[model samples]
Every structure is written in structure tokens, then in C-alpha cells.
Target: MSNIVSKSSILILGGSYFIGRKIAEVFEEYGYSVSILNRGTKPLTSLNIEQITCDRNDTECMKKALNDRRFDCVVDVSFKDSSWVENLCDTLDFETVKSFVFISTSAVYDIENLKIPFKENDKLAENKYWTSYGLEKINAEKYYTDYFASMNTRLIILRPPYIYGENNYAKRESLIFKHICESNPIIIPKTNPKLQFIYTDDLAKIINHLFKNNASGTFNVGNKKSMTARDWVNACAKVVDKKVKIIECDYKSLNRNVRDFFPFFDYDNVLDVRKINSIFNEETPIETGLSNAYKWFLDNKSQIAFKENIEKNICEILAKSN
Candidate 1:
């Protein structure tokens, strides 16, 4: 059995949305006292977590919220940069903290992103699509790595590919599932981009995996397999027990932004999980993850916005092209 104390405390930098919410729930289930720090936007519905409502970029607010506080583990699940990292680390009472986990994306390796599977040691560059998002994360990763080395702290950075699961705010799998559920026509590009994905719940479990094992260093956390957009749509269609009408066309060639209709970029984003899987082994297939997501959509579809304006625009573009 693993030797981590389930009762240890943790502080999540952002715990209201998809990834952070799932992680907070998992740690709480493991008996960890969970606390979340974020600008109070959404209320934490399910977990009994302590909330520190303040923007992390506000150095004074962060200091006030985290003064003299300690955590066994701290995970930055928010979209933050090196400045946020510096402010949080400076404000945190690391004297009692053991591990700090930063959620970096596979976008870090985006210059060569479409060509090959990125391992932990891959070269990071600015992604044309993700742009500055990748560069900022690389800087944050560097800062955390350098900062933690001087202390008795385990800094673990996870470079995950496109994450999908229940309550995902991103209009990815859920959007397709909704279209399929509503018997709507779905669009895709001719050169179907293959992408790697990780389940949100599995990622939450992986965070706890590192926290328990005290694992340090960066690791790619995702399923090693890759699936094209059509294959992905077909998988969602299978779960929904609905046949999908997939129209393959180069949206860009039509002078239409692909994102106006499609969810993922026009390139593959695959990650090599051998480093993290060698330790955590928390890969959940899309088939399984989509099943749960479909069930949640059925129960809470009212809560999910289908982006009607974008849908209408996509139809107009496709109709005119036809």
C-alpha cells in the first residue's frame, strides 16, 4: 500500500472549474484538508474546502490570504505565469510545505507539436495557435524548478495534452456529443488532426499520485495513443449510440476560421506519458471518459452552453461553400 498520509492538507491555486474542482474532490476523498485560492467567481459546490478569494497576481492580497499558512502539497491548477508563480511562492509559508505541483501543458513543445510525440525533454517554443500561452508556461516551469531546488521541496510539473472529462468548460468532446445528441451535422477539416487526450479525473488522481509518492521533476501525463478528429467523433457517437454526419472540408480554405466550427486546432498535440505512467499509470481512454461526460451532459445539459451563435455561423459558412 502507498504510504502517504491521507489526512495531510493541500492548497489548490484554482479549484472552481473543471480540472481544479475534480482535483479538490479527489484529495478530499483521500481525507486531505483541501483549500482553494482564486478570485471568487464560482462557488465550490460539492467539496468542503476552505476558500481564499483573491487574485494570485495581487501580491499584497496573496500575502494576506496565505500568511503563516502551510500545506503538505500545493498545486497550481490555474492558468498562471512566472509572475504568479513568484508572488505565490513568496507569499506561501513553504516552511511546512513538502511538494508543489504546477500544471503545464503539452503546448510547451508546440514548435514540433504536430510532427512527433513530445517527451519530457522536448524543446519548447511558441505555438502559432497557442502563441504566448506556451512561452509563459515554460517560464513558469523554469521559475518553479529553480526556486524549489534550493529548498526541501518536491516541485512536480505536469505537461498534459488536451484534457477532457465531465463539466469541461472547453467546447471539445461535450460540444460534439451535444451535436450528435441533437442530431446536428458536425464539421471537420480534410487533414484530420490527431490529438492525444487525458481524462480530468485521471489527472486529478495523478496529482495525488505525485503528492503521495513525493515525486519531483516534470512529467508528461497523458495517454500515449493518438486519435484523429473523425475517430474521436465516432467514439463519442458510439457512446451516445448515435450515427454522426461528419462533413470533411478544409475550413481555412473556405476562408472560414476552423475554430468557428471545430473545437481542437488543425494540428495534432500528442504527448509521451512514459515518464509519468512509469510511476502513476493513470491513463483513462476517451471511450471511458466520454461515457461519463455524455451521462453528465444528459443530466446537466441545461448548464452547458452550446454556443448557438458560433453554430449558426458555421452553418452559414458551410451552406455558402456548398
Candidate 2:
């Protein structure tokens, strides 16, 4: 992270998963110096980036891993716990960091009476689906803002809805692909809830743009249009060039939860993208993103190990035909 290397240095907190991995690759491709700090569980084999192996919560390890290195930007991609934010910041050389970016979630918004397009200034309260997770994200944002305010370090918060694309380990896209590919019925709720999504590479581009512009503020990043469950299924189906069977059931009538049989719940969480779009508007369309995801699933199908219970549960629920 020292200026000796000469390229702009960016330190990523979690750099092995979908969003973090995409950001790392994007930065590296554009000739930026990139470094990753995370537990040595997942390896970014494709990129030859410097990786620091340590638990983020370990104060001693954090101090040793970071040392006194300085970075042009510090990106927080997987800070689910506020304590982790405090632990990392407390251990870091704040003055050495030029800017900070925290990857927040759309869950920070209250679910009830949600704005059609959720803005950054919308209400933030606990909801059943994301109560603890959302609250923790809110706290993390607060802690980072409060901590950096006194230091005058530029801080940016990005709240994104469902992040999807190639190599998504969340099973949201792959689950749909699995059902359609296997000729299994895709069960969905009667209510069609529109949800927002952001492609992995598009997000990477946005972050890179922000870094280049030295932007700092809270932003809701996603595609302007919303996609319903059927829209998602249709996109994946088109990738395979096949028509599929769909079973829409009343979610409330079922004893088991709708999420037990599906990846996304029957609810809307679309985000407003006016601010981000005004800055960087090159967004990947839903059809293109799903096609990319389908290609990745085809390549990694044999390697993907799905929970048998989830598949079986989908079948069981479809049998009742409720």
C-alpha cells in the first residue's frame, strides 16, 4: 500500500465473493493496485493480487496485517457486523486512507409502505425479513460516518438490492436455472412483487467510476427498472431457449413459508438509481445479466452442490398445488 509501487492503491476488506471478486478484477484490469484482506477460506485464483489472511475481528491480527500501510481507498465489501467496522477502523491508520466505501444493502429500508423506487433518504427501520441484518448494516454505516467525520476522511455508502450475475453463490439465479433445466415446475407466489437488481460487472464499473471521481456520499445503486419473479424466470428460460412450467400459489395459505420453496420472498425492494445513474448510467440489462449467469451455471453445474432439501421442498410444495 506504500506509494513505492506507483499505481493508485485500493484495499478491499472482503475480496473473494461475487461483488468483491468482481470489483477486484475490475480494478486490476484497469491497472490499479489492489489488495485483499480476508480469512483464507476462498482464493481468488484468477487474479494475482496481494491477499492478507486474518480474521477481521482479531484486533492483534488486524494490526499486524494492515501494519502502517496507506491506501488511496479502503472498500468495505462484507462488513455485516458493526463491531467488525469498529474493529477494522480502530486498527487502521485513518489519516493514511484517502477515501472509504461501505457496501450497504437495501434491507436498511423499512418494508412497510415502501416507496415505489426506494430513495437514499427513505425511512430505515427493522422489518421481519431483514431485521437483524438490516439493523447491523445501519449501525455499520453510522459507525463509519461518525468515526470518519472527525478525521475528515471522505466516506461513501452504497445500498444495493439483489446483486446478481456470473459466479453468484447465493443460488438465486442458479436455483431458477436448476428448476427450468430439470423440467421441474417453478413455483412462485400469486402476488407479483417487483424487485431491483444490479449486475456484478456493472457494480464494479460504478465503484471504479466513483474512485476515479473521488465521489463521497450515500447512494442507492441498481437498474432503474424492476423485475418480477416471472420476469426473472423468463429471462433465465430464454437463455436456454425453452418455455417452462410455472405454478403460482397463494403464499399466505401455505403453512410453510414461500421462501422455503423459492430463493426470493414475495416482496418488493426496488431501489432508486437517479443519483448513481446521473453519474454513471451504463447499466447491464436484466436479459443480458441473466444470460451471463446462465452461461456460468452451465460451466459450473457439475461443481455446484445444492442443498437436497431445498430441491425436495420445492417438489413437495408443488405437489399440494396450493
Candidate 3:
């Protein structure tokens, strides 16, 4: 069935998200039929796309939604559970699916040091039962990679460190812009710790590259250059031409509530992107991305409804733990 003129019918697992939506946009622009499997709360206007609301945790629901149809590719940006992925591998098999792309995280790498860049073959985290959110993703990647090793379904694992841009769920740019607009000083543990960041649009381009080239390996998507936390804050400030002080503080002194969830401030694992650069050389400058993100924040800040679920969930969990 594969031919030079063949177009892929792609099923994006978390197509409502920033990165997932951008990938769908790029795929549709290139004449591919894209469908999404999400919560179906977000409205999409793409004529060539369809969305099926299915909770990712429900195995029977997934099998029902996918059993009647086959997809050329499945881009899973929300596959947090290893069991779900393994079940899909067994059910879908190689005969029904061609490619599987799992959006893993660079969080799978050890970040105790801020100097070394992580390679694609670096050791994954060993502890899945503890620590940050990396373990779930790590297990999912391993399951997919091993499950598809003997099948016709080629596995592609994309590990992105930190993603920011318009329609971002992380609210990283919004957080920075809010502080900048309020003239409130941003705080960092140190001015020298570096981190990797990639804009959502740029990431979409990389996913498109994989689609065209049939790249079948684990690739890292991040800027070639790493930026210090202080530099990033200052860069955002410079982009907006806002004068705001930056407070330097120890990790321990930051609000315990915020610090408990955001422990990356104390570590940096720079990603080695030579393999990514070998394919897509056009990189979005951090300064330019900051400017665009700041503009988006300025234009849409008033429309954003702040949800307290994160705060509520954190407090509830903490209270139970105590």
C-alpha cells in the first residue's frame, strides 16, 4: 500500500496540546489526513480532521475507538502509561499501523550536573516508582521501542526538554510575561545554570521532517545553544523592553509550594542536538521566540482563565502526605 504518492492518515493522541496541534497543522498543510484523540473540550476547525474523545486510561475505550479503522501513523504525545502503549502494540500490531511516534521527555536524563550534554543513547532513569514525572515517560518509551523492534511498525521517540510558545499549557512564557508586566523581579537559584528550550512551531517543523524522511530513531528536539535561567529571564525582559529586577535566591528559599514541584531550577542537563541539526538546521532564535511569545501574552492575557486545579491538587496531596 505504500507508494511515493501515498498520503498518511495520522492519529494524534493529544492533538489539542500546543505541540500536538502544531504538528497536526503542519501535517494538514502538507496534504495529510489528521485526526485527534483527546478530551474533545477544545474546538478545532480543520476540515480534514476528526476528533474522538477517549480517556487514555480506559483500555476498552481505546480498543473500541481504534478497532474499526487503521491509521498510517499514530503520534502519541499523551502516552504517559506504559501499560496503555503495550496494549496498543499488542492490539494494533504491525499489520494495522506503520509508524508510532511517542513524545518523551529529556527529563529521562540525569540532571545533577549543568555542564554535560545528553546524547540519544544516554542511560535512562532507573527509578520508575519514585521521583519526578520522567519515569512514566521512560517506561513508555522502552515499551514502545521494544514492542516494535520486531514489527513493521517503526518506532520514533522524540525527546524535548522544555517547550514554549503560543497555546502552551505549561504557561512558562505567560509566567515570565506576567512577572515582566507586573515589574516583578524574576527569581533564579543561580545566574549560571543552563537549560534547553524549543519553541512549539520549530518543534512542528522537526516532526514534519520525520514524516517526510521516515526517520526511525530517537531524536532530541531542542535549540543547539543552551541559555542560563537568568539569561532567559533577562532576554524576555529585553524583548518586552521591560525593566524588572531579577532576584537571585537559593533553591531552598523559594516558596516551598512552588519549589516542591519545580526542582529543575537546581539542575541542568543540556541536550546534545547534533543529530537533530543534521536534519533540520533552521533553528528559532530564543530572542525571537521570546518576542513572539511576549506579544501573544500581551494580546491574550486578559482572556486566559486561571485554573486552580494544580494548586488544589498539590495542596491536597501534600496534606495527605503530611
Better of 1 and 2 by TM-score: 2
Q: What is the per-residue lDDT of model 1 for residues 1-322, given as tens digits with 9 covering 90 to 100?
A: 3534557999998988889989888787777889998997998865578888999879999999998887889999896677888898788989888898999988888555445777788777887878889899988888888888899988889988889988889868888888898898788888899878888888988888787787888888887688998899999999999999888877766777778888988887787777887887856777899899899888888878878877897778669757
The residue ranges of model 1 lying beyond 4 angstroms of the native Cα positions read: 1-4
Q: List model 3 lDDT by residue over 191-223, tens digit each.
A: 357778998888877776776677789998899
Q: What lDDT score is found at residue 310 in candidate 1?
A: 79
TM-score of 3: 0.86
Off by over 4 Å in 2: 1-6
Question: What shift in Å separates residue 117 of candidate 2 from its native position after superposition?
Answer: 1.3
Best by TM-score: 2
User: What clash pairs does model 1 have?
Assistant: none
